[model samples]
Target: MTRSTPTKPQANPGAKPRVIHPWPLRLTHWLNAVAVVMMIGSGWQIYDASPIFGFTFPPLITIGGWLGAAIAWHLAMMWLLVVNGLIYFLWSATTGHFRKIFPLSPRAFWHDLTAALTFNLKHEPGVYNAVQKLLYFGVLCAGVVIVLSGLAIWKPVQLWFLTDALGGFVIARYVHFFAMAAIAGFLFIHLLLVAMVPKVLPPMITGGRIEP
Candidate 1:
């Protein structure tokens, strides 16, 4: 009788997951996630006081029971978010991570855009594409806008200049709302992209690449 041949395990094609996110990045990232979630919930509750839409958001999705509680929660989360974001940005700048994240050349952006549109998006090792650069930078800028607008709304009398530049208190409030919406949208898309490339997320948590 002929001896049966044993089957070999299939090899992983992509590069082994590595420590892409350093300790600082991972910590700040998770902290940011937590803060943002808290902010969203508390924000909804606060919005209930003067909802822009026809109806108020469901209580189930909101953080606090009343306006006062909501404001407290919102303020608390805001501080956490601000602190974590500052740390992240500072670390990235010091580590020269900005070069990988911020697209400076228009040619590179065009190439990346073409790749994305053609479903040929390339995931470089430890590098972000043009789309990612733009989106991330946009989110950061939006956060700044939200913070400024929130301050204006929260203390219109004290921060009169901000409110005035934003076309007064009501307009500032709307800007804050819109900025929050943009962040929410980005969060959704970010998760979707992660789902599409499951390998990318593990490094964020474990801080090491998974061996193929």
Candidate 2:
């Protein structure tokens, strides 16, 4: 008599959904990264030309060789940033991306903040922890402020209302500078966390595998 082989178990189709970073989110994220780098570099060059603050960024670190070149690059990247931002916002709104960062609670934030400071925070793939949500929200607000301040600086005469609301060109410049600082700070911490948690990098690049 011939012996029969046992069947292997199949995956459950109704199991919990997997975490994915979705293509649209990934695309917008990378484009934003490129735009932010170019904008910041060129902006630094422009700042060096007529700095509001005492110090200036190193020439080597800045984009464009001169003020005029920097202005050109900055203007070009501005459009990319604006358009891409709009697309990201629209997509987020339509696809319920905002849900991930909503319902922020001070209690949760405090708890997570403590956990993070103590290095006890655990990262869940595809889910934004309280601290993460706050950071993301903060950056989004900074992005809007930066763009508006940039516009006020770029077209003070035409956008006189905006410039006036921001307390004129000088004040607008300050606002713009601080906004850039906020973004730079966020980027620094963001990169540091990525370095510490290298595994998280792959999911952002490749829509991560689902956990049961």
Candidate 3:
């Protein structure tokens, strides 16, 4: 039967595109995301008992019912965070990422600090500055503290040694709460900075390249 129908020309394929988020960053980001969500949910449950801001409403149920559930969720998420954070720390240390993030020179520190402040003031800040490094370091350290304090309070019977090491149950609880508050505060500032920059979120969310 007659001639074959003319076929449409196909475009030539090229090399695969590079993803923005490296495997390590993506894993850490997602694990942190899950952990933070669980932390917030359980935190609300725990807070229902005290009912700050003059609000006395329960979270999903009465204070006591949800509090135990919240603790369970919080503890589970804490394990995930601890494992993921440790992996990230080890990866960064072994690779050159740690050096890039934590510049040791005094001049570099001052330069980064100035750049960050200037950038905040509507001046051009080149990539991440010293303040950003410091913040990252602080968050990492805070995460460690949170995990230790959490263990001390959460498993006083099983981890009586840690509980005793950190003074007592009451002090451990207090430190855990403060660490949570610090992490929350950091989250607030992180969100604010992202909103202000808008450009920052795309890299983490879509694995897109961030243009300078």
Q: Which ten residues in a row have the lowest lDDT in candidate 1?
A: 12-21
The runs of at least 3 residues in candidate 2 whose Cα sits more than 4 Å from the true structure, single-residue gaps closed, are: 1-11, 14-19
Please give the CA lDDT of all the candidate structures.
Answer: 0.86, 0.92, 0.70
Per-model TM-score, in order, reads: 0.84, 0.91, 0.73
Per-residue C-alpha lDDT of model 2 across residues 76-177, encoded as one tens digit per residue: 988999999999999999999999999899999999989988989998888889988998999999999999999999999999999999999999999999
Residue pairs in candidate 3 whose N, alpha carbon or C atoms collide under 3 angstroms: none
Backbone clashes, candidate 2 = 0
lDDT of 2 at 84: 92
lDDT by residue for model 1 over 1-212, one digit each (tens)? 99999999787786565567788988998998998888988999999999877888899999988999989999999999988889988998998877777655678778987987787987854578877787888889988999899999989999899899999998998899999999999899899778866778877888865355
Local distance difference test, candidate 3:
0.70
In model 1, state the lDDT of residue 128: 83
RMSD of each: 7.2, 5.1, 10.6
Residue 180 accuracy (lDDT) in model 3:
72
Model 2 per-residue lDDT at 50:
93
Better of 1 and 3 by lDDT: 1
Model 3 stretches astray by more than 4 angstroms:
1-20, 47-65, 104-127, 210-212
10 residues in a row with least lDDT, candidate 3: 120-129
